[model samples]
Target: MFRRQFLGLGAAVLAFGLSLCGTAGADPLPDLKGRTIVAVTENAYFPLNFTDPKTGEGIGWEYDAMNEIARRLDAKVEWKTSSWDAMIQAVQAGQFDIGMDGISITDERKKQVDFSDPYMVSEQFMLVRANENRFTDAKSFAADPKLFVGAQAGTTNYFVSVSDLLGGDDKSPRLRLFETFGASVQALKVGDVDTVLMDKAGAEGNIAASPDRFKIIGNGLGHDEFGFILKKGSDLLAPVDAALAAMKADGTLKALDKKWFYDYRAAH
Candidate 1:
């Protein structure tokens, strides 16, 4: 969606104008009581999703969103952490009812798994070392063979970086694939990769935490939209949509946005 359209929807949502899904009128929110809804995440999209430092429990924005959805549905949540590449596959295979990582909404993805209303919208940004700024421009990365850009497998950012920046060929800068965003970022720090491309929020949060040592690169990868993942045609999509709409309408989304992404707000 265009920023204008998105902002329009945001206004309507804020003004309580979202219409209920026709199917939801009969769907009855499902009897989620005593039942478990599995949620898949990478635990690498910081603030949006991450593992607790001490307890190792999953915690973050997506985590909080799932918790809210589960409570509204009267269901218990079973969080399943997985590689970013495996998240959509797991949900498509019916291993989980929802995938809550900061997965972007795209036309290609709509074929594999259904997505509810977008919970957040933003662009992709590259993470690079503070001292080096070569990756800030596409022209530099496009010309250099020495600079390697890292992106997780099965993500739109990877595809875009390869097609748009790398010219869909192997002769240009190479894309090093990581199983997780965290791993990819670590690769950057260890000098295994020249830059790591990820969602804007994650990149911003990491940059904020270590402002003296890191920064986001490039003009940003444009209009990335995020939504919860569900098996294509799953019965649960309607209620999930409704809950997300309610969350946005009631200001819960902004509050949660502040909690997780205070320094950088996730686009709506």
Candidate 2:
């Protein structure tokens, strides 16, 4: 399970306001008229994009949002799966028409693929076992060299572990790299690592799924914005952005957030 604390009070306030606000309008845009799009995701990130443990069905906020986007754009989406490490390059190579698995927008990544407008903004937090009490925050965790952090390589979590959570050294041995966020969390569950860094949305989903097993520690590290990825100069970018803008303007985006982030948690 996961827990969350905002990076700052102001951010928390803004998040709350955004959640309750209705969309301003639904402007018309270029429509694909039933063109097919292949979208890929690593079915590992809980609440964003993951296979249901019981049903083995892919489901999450990203799935819901993408479905709505395809509907609005008059497109058909064929879902695909890829490892997180290979997703970017695969998208860049034109193996997939689009990709999304809570990918953060960053300059380094932008060099490889174009990103749609920001869809969601969140902050990173420390995810730890429920009974954890050794150290409360990043500083204390870093002080004890024995305390290890689990993270997936080339992710926001790994970068945060090296730069903010661990010391500014990427080679720090105290950090354990895993192939997926689920694997890192599994390591934490089995006492292989002291903590795993995850965004607030992810943490909440994990915690909701396994409330007794995990908890979040300290305030969040910093802000991050998630977006969809496409091949460089892909013509699909504009229509996709238009769909997203339309969703935001019509309150569909906020409604989805509430359905997945709040209502889904309660139901689960």
Candidate 3:
């Protein structure tokens, strides 16, 4: 399935999005054809969105999950990659049908864009070098702005690090921009960044690939939900929710989670 078929629905999407409003599951999904959904992601967050080490293909939980949802909707997907910061904003700006990343559904983010039902839930966590106990949790990280807690710019982790950890809720992190989470993880391994703010699930992949280099610190900063993001009012949301509902009800979501994520966990 290719994207060209969806042009008509794409145009319909542009015209009707703003007028359509309600929860995702409020109405039944419409029959859609000749529609391609342009989904955006940053292949930085492992297990969710990441470049495959073997074929260099973009592969991860989000990749597989979105493709599955698209199949059920009889829609095709064209994926665009960018820095994590721009992915959400692009969806908000109507540049894409939806954004699929390990995007946490935070209240602050909901103000900017709408989200599907949460697909995966994981605790916000920190990764620090082995034997480095000087810094542990968000509170300790906030004690010193001089310490570099690396995160992709404009992400929830970046926001959390800047406000809740380094600065205050109102402040942004001192700002160390990286092209991807892999680079930031490398920085953490070498101590270039004192810590890396990541989801517990994502950090697990990094830890599996590089043992003795990184470890989770402190209790998780608490749980966060990940979801597919779209513009505030888009026709596409209903079908996505519908597909997700089917996936959730039949245990498909759990099975897929275990396939990509080591543990089987669903975001409720």
Candidate 4:
């Protein structure tokens, strides 16, 4: 997620209004003339996007949001999956028309890919095993030399572990790297790592999955916003943004957040 000011629901709602200001016209929604757009995401980001354990099919907030956007625009979406590490580069290479994996709209990433309006505001939190209580927060965790943090490499989670918890030491031996967020969480489960930094939504999803196994402690660590990614100067940018604005105006976005983050619980 792109680092920014801590935004409540009101601020997130205001962000949608601001995005609408960019496209000047009587109609905020656009029709894609039945065109098919290819969209890609890592099907491992819980609540945002992930495989439903019961059906083994991809489904989450992003899936619903993108499908709704396509419907509103009168377009068809072709879903594809890629590793989180390769998603941005693959989209930039023109392999996908759109990408969404709770991608943060950071200035550095903006240089490589165009981003849609902020869809969700999130904050990083400490996810730890429920039974353990060695450290309560970032500061307490940092004080313990035996503590180790699990994080996916080249992600907001990893950077936050390094910058916020580890005093900007990217090479800290206490940090353990994994290929995916799921993997990092797995490490935490098996005692390979003590904690995992995750967005509040994701942390909640995991906690819901195994309430007796995991819990989030401490206040949020960083303020961030999520947006969909497109290739630099992609032709679909305006239409996608317009559809998002319409969704926000009609309460579709808020409803989706409520469904995936607050209501939906995976069967264990």
Candidate 4 segments whose C-alpha is farther than 4 A from its true place: 1-28, 266-268
Q: How are the candidates ranked when ordered by lDDT, highest leading?
A: 2, 4, 1, 3
Instruction: Residues 1-268, candidate 1: write the lDDT tens digits.
Output: 0001123334454334223322343334445666788888877778787766658787777887788777767788887877776778889999988887777888888999999899998777767888886656777877887888887767776777787668886344477887777777778887888877667767777776555677766777767778888998998898788777766765768756655665223331
For model 1, the run of ten residues with the poorest summed lDDT: 1-10
Question: How high is the CA lDDT of each candidate model?
Answer: 0.72, 0.84, 0.72, 0.83
Q: Estimate each model's TM-score.
A: 0.81, 0.90, 0.78, 0.89
Clash count of each predicted structure: 0, 4, 7, 0
lDDT of 4: 0.83
Q: List where candidate 1 sits over 4 angstroms from the true fold.
A: 1-31, 170-173, 263-268
RMSD of each: 6.9, 5.9, 9.7, 6.4
lDDT of 2: 0.84
Tens digits of per-residue lDDT, candidate 2, 1-268, equal 1112223443353355345333344356677978999999998887778887668778877887898788768789999999999999999999999999889899999999999999999788999999999999988998898899999999988898898877788888898899888999999999999999998878888788787999999999978899999999999999999888877865667766766676667666
| Candidate 3 RMSD computed on C-alpha atoms after optimal superposition onto the true structure | 9.7
